[model samples]
Target chain A: MKPLHISAYTTVSALGRGNAAMLEALRAGKSGLQPLHFPPAELKTYVGFVEGLEHEPLPEELAAFECRNNRLARLALRQDDFEQQVAALRERHGASRVAVLIGTSTSGILNTELAFRRRNEAGELPVEFDFVHSHQLSSLVDFVRRLLQLQGPGFTVSTACSSSAKVFADAWRLMAAGLCDAAVVGGVDSLCLTTLYGFNSLELVSAEPCRPADSQRNGISIGEAAGFAILEREPVEGSRGQLLGFGESSDAYHMSTPHPDGLGAVEAMQAALARAGLASSDIDYINLHGTATPSNDRSEDRAITTVFGTNTPCSSTKGWTGHTLGAAGITEAIIAMQCIEHGLMPASLNTRQLDPDFGSTILLEQRETTVNRVLSNSFGFGGSNCSLIFGGRNDHPLP
Target chain B: MTTLYLDNLGVVAPGLSDWPGAAKVLRGEADHLAEPLKLTAPELLPATERRRSSDSTRLALRAAEQALSLEAAQRLQPAAVFSSAYGDPTITHKLCELLSGTPPMASPTLFHNSVHNAPAGYWSIATANPMTTTSIAAGDESFATGLLYAAAQVVAEQRPVLLISYDLPYPKPLSEKCEVSAPFASALLLSHQASAQSIAQLSLSLDKGPETIMDLPLESLRRGNPAARALPLLAILASASGECLLPYLAEQRLHITVTPCR
Candidate 1:
């Protein structure tokens, strides 16, 4: 796996808009999970919702692409100077040399949900409803690609939670194939009634702030976010993170539940370590795909022990940001990159007591330690799994 | 740009059942009629899993079965890229209607089956293959985008790839708006290893021009079904001469020139 420079990156999670907001939240041990206050007030679960998006208006020219998901994409692109960063990238790489690959589970199904509710007496969608641009899954990638004015290859990877994480792998392969010089790889998934009640119907929604790796952990708290990163062949002067390698695999076990023993999880982690030319012991910390579900934590714990032997510290940041679903890959990837840049180990947020049955060591405090390399794990439904390793520079300020 | 060898092909669309059937239409010896595909479930999957699979999943598995034999599929365990314009509109509509009800709770099975990668997951489980699989979407350009991505992987990794593009019509409200007329699925077994089974070698490069559309008979097919985006390339593979162009990404199309090996 060749190393690609992470020239620019930003995240718009409940923690707030960019890397600074995320870094501050992690260092200050802040939790972004809030009580279920949005519509479907009956859903009795918490979520990491991006605030004030309903008020943010899309530009007139892009009004045809209006939707909660696209609005989140527009807002997230504005933060961390993400738009400006891509503009400079287009200049350096040539607009035709750069590609756009984004991941999203449900692009704008919320808009369709609204259209369905507003169906006319004839059962037709509203007059202004533009199904092609708004409800299409590829619309997310198209929206971002048009915004960046990129002319190279582009597509949307939608393998559930691992969707965005797999984009890093796609960018790497395409660049290796000499197809694209640079790529804007990220994801955005805004909150909607579908996700809110969907998980609840599955009986996987945690009413209170979720606790990962806790014996009493019941289920997950849904979160919505948008995150993006620029990956190029050469490192720029201000580049802070380098993607060393990524490993992807399917569980082949179940559709909804993970492999009870986390076989696919172990394979993804080992593959990432092997590609990075590093052993498990060299990984300073692991960002677990801990969704605070009893089954997921136990299964992943087994896999972690099978590979790393429980010496390295690990935590599930979902306790802080909830589970951002499709946007989680980029959200956690940025957090891992920030962990590499700043020697701050974020605490596994809401865990009061760790389950003693788990074999991996779970960190519960923000440790100011020497962090060199970090492995981030994102496993999705139907057994889709991706593990990304980010590290290059050894220089980091101790918190 | 690298050249990819198309080892074998499988297609299921209205009137055109297989590559041989499609070749007739491509040659104008026969006409492509607008009709529904009569598909049978792939026996490769376990009976229980097969019963639970969705129409889109069945469409992909049927194409996959035709492209590769049982022994070959098991022996190669090829990594797959399942591309679809719409995941499972039936399941999506069902879930939507369920969620809109009075304090709705979605059926967990329907929710899982609605994922874009549901087909890919089913393929992996049915074949018992552990290799990495990806499912992507790119609207009307899904077929071309998927082929380009698979070709790059096959070239860069030098391994055979199973590329499957499948889509189906939505139920009520979405059906009227969406252009998908009928169910369609196509599969291409691509490899860098040239062998006797190889039909043609395709090389593609970025062309800054308008997208190439097929002629009259196939034009409507291409316009109507998103999965029919492969018609141009498939027709070229079935023909001895002439080239085809496919939409790669925004403002750029891939000019593909096919060289027959036979």
Candidate 2:
């Protein structure tokens, strides 16, 4: 496997401010979900809302790109010590060698939609309105690159839930193929009436996000988040973190539902293990893309059963932060990496009764464990599945 | 690296919908695209499933059906990769509207289809292949990204892979960014083994050149017509050897080297 290094990473979900805050929330079994009150609608539901975000004004530089989603991205990128780390990378590897890849379903479109609605009613857009601020999907990635003052291969992946998860694969390929030396990979999705009402229209949103593997599980609670990770070729002997392998599979099964047999999920997990040159038992913790949806949990449970059997400790962080859609992949990947950093596996929240079909291997409560290799699973709507393996530097002894 | 052959092809575009129909147009047997090929969802998809899928999903599934119609059942399990530029913008726009409102509510159908991999998901279920699938989006470079992703999966997994790329014009207002007409989907069943009439080899690289390839119309190229891109490769292969340079991105370019089998 090509050597890939995660030099720096940052995440801002309902889990909290930085990686430390996220780890603490996971350990405490605290959830970031809260009932959101905004425009009057027929249906109201819980959301993984980030507190104190509405008050944070954008910096003068990013003022033009302001929107709920980009605002969250600005705050996430503002993590303590994050800029300094990124700056060092920029200095070391010229801006052109640093690539930017963002996974977002709605890239400030909500802002544009608001502006459009006003314009439609009044027959004109406001004089101060800047359509470029919210129009193209690439704007988010472009904005981030300019803000960071780095240039390389700038790309925006908008593949629904798997968008950001796939960014890791792209970054790995770019670095391995010598396209770029370093890359910033992450996703940003803000909670908006569109997602809320859209999910409500589909009837997939649960009144409450139920237990992931529990028999009584209902559906998922949507959330907004901004999660980013910096990947580069690993340096000599000692390095911050390493990306072992990322395995991807396409089910071509259904638009909305996963295959009943979980074939794609199994293939992805197996492929990741093969890429990492490790057996299933080698994984200490599994950060499941447990969106809490009945079909998703069931299919994923079957896949887990086929791979780890009844041993690996697995939990869904969606209970802490509602499914962040595209951000879920990276958000959960960051959490898995945190677990590897600190030797603890976070428990799944709201889980009381486990599904009889699900094996006992699924961890229901937070527990302490010796961590090394962590497997993170992300399955998107189109049966597009990816399983990423993350481990410490020493996990793979030098060749 | 193993050489991948284009064993079968499928497309559901603005004018062409089925394999025979699309092939006819590609072969210059037909003069125009049909009306059924232009049919929109709510009409094309079943009610039960229609409520769950986005327009992209519908278009992709239709294209997948056309691509797989002639292939055997055993070939269905090949690893799959789906690519798109804009993804489900219609649902995305609706989701945005719901979010800006007082009480947020999301449409389950739209949310389900909003996933970038929804088309891949639908194709897998519709075909019941029980294989691995990957969904990718890379802005304007999606075609190249999709090819790279498919090639990687084939090399890593050592299995045949299905590469599908689709893009639809966002409904009203949002359509400004895109120039293509009607929703379009194209599928290529790529395998390590060569078939009856082999397609040309794909070689990608970074090169400096004039920004545009004036030799071919952008519309025909964007429509996935072989004449503009695929036919050139076929012509090169038929001549025993040939090469053509295609504009990749602004900073990079792709030079395709083609050689026909004896």
Candidate 3:
């Protein structure tokens, strides 16, 4: 796979808006997780919920597309000048030549969840309910495309946690196939009753703030986030980093649980390495999928040890932002790029002690290093797995 | 332009059970019937998992099983692209109601099966094929978008791909908003290399023209279900050869040129 330039990117999560807030939180090791206070469905678990979405609706002209998920997407677009960057891209490649590929597990089902509460006697939902623009999985891509006024091919990938990560791969292929000269790839997922109670039902929601790879770790802290990135065939004037390679695979062993041995994770990582033409030693850091769940951390540990071994430093930023689900891929991918630029590799925030049984080198404290190349892992429900490799343009030569 | 071979086909809709049987209806040899959708667990899944499968998963797997014949199913393990406009409407309705209940306790089985890629996950487990799989959506154009993604994979990876597109109507309150009233699913085994058994060759290009609409009894089916939007293309395959346009993104259409190989 040929390298594509990540010319611009931005994200909004519990850590706050844009790359600056994320960098500040990581540098200070400040976690954005807070006690669960979302109204309606009550759960004891903490969440990385972004405040003020309900108060701030979308602009009036785009009223039909109003939803919490789209609100977050527009918020992220406003930050880091991502909207302007997309506009410049459209000018360079034409509106019809730019594709939108956004990922989301649940686009805006909160509207439907709320509508169900207000159903009338005849079981008819409120007349104002708009399922197509609000709750549909493709609404994310459609909203983003309309916001940016791009007329190219657009779609939404909904493969749970691997959704956003896979969008980068999709963008690369579309560009390689000459379908689009530049592409917009990202993910947006908002906190909803379905996810809160859903994860609780599966026994995967941690009551306290998540501690990835910790000895006393319990489960995940759900988070809502929106992130976007511009992928161009070549580096533009202010290119940030380049997408080196990506690998995707399935566990095929279980739907919610990962493989005990992490064999599928190993396949995805190995494939990414092969595609990037890089050895395990070449990666300076790894952004572990580390949802903080016992099975996930254990399985990912085995996979990491099988490939990169215990020498390479790695940590899960999920401790700070919680598991953003679908947005995790792009969020972590952007963090991997930050590690390349800022030289600050974060520790597993909120984690007290590393799991003694794990063999891999799980970092518990922050370290400043000359990070060149980094690999980020995102594994979703249904055993979908993706691994992405990112690097600084100058230091790591293209394969 | 990239081209892919349609090695095999699968169909599961109101009157369409399988490709061969449905071809008769498409070729005008038989009338299009209005029978309820028939769904059963894909035997590929274990008994326990099969019991836990939802209608969406069953519909998708049923078509996938038909498309991947016993020979190909054993000899070639193709990566899959599962697309649906509204994935598993029944599951979504059930989960919504479950969440709206007092104290709101969700069902673990339903939550896991609610992901858009649930069928893809079940397929991976059923076939034990750990290749890459993706679940995508483009609303009403989900089938065309999935085809584009599958075709891109075939050309870029040079590997066979199984594209399964399915959608089930929502119940009651939700149904009033998005009026998808029927269940439809179809699977196409696409590859870059053509074989002796290849049924048709597909070449896709983007356009802004109108889409090919279905006629007579199939028109309602095509409009009612997102997956059934492939009726025109399927009709072309049933006949000898032709070109048809399917809706893509806003104002864009996927102009597909079909060349019969068999």
- For candidate 3 chain B, the 10 contiguous residues with the lowest summed lDDT are B68-77
Interface RMSD for candidate number 1?
1.4
Q: Give the alpha carbon lDDT tens digit for every residue of B6-43 in model 2.
A: 66666666555655665555445566443434435523
Model 3 residue B183 distance off true place after TM-score fit, in angstroms: 0.9
DockQ of each: 0.71, 0.35, 0.85
Candidate 1 chain B: worst 10 consecutive residues by lDDT?
Answer: B96-105
The DockQ-based order of candidates, best leading, equals: 3, 1, 2
Superposed on the true chain A, the predicted chain A of model 2 yields a TM-score of 0.95
**TM-score value, chain A, candidate 3:** 0.99
- Measured by TM-score, the strongest candidate is 3
Residue-wise C-alpha lDDT for candidate 2, range A170-221, written one tens digit per residue: 7876665556789889899987655666666766688875467778888888
Comparing 1 and 2 on DockQ, the stronger one:
1
Question: In candidate 3, which residue pairs get closer than 3 Å at backbone N, Cα or C atoms, i.e. clash?
Answer: none
> Which of 2 and 3 is ahead in TM-score?
3
Give per-residue CA lDDT, model 1, range B1-262, as digits (tens). 7788888889888788777888888888887886767656777677888878888888888888889876887788787899998888888888877766666557878888888888888887887777789999999889888988898888877889999998888998888778687777899999987899888888877676766788886787787778888888877777765677777666567788899877
Flag clash pairs in model 1: none
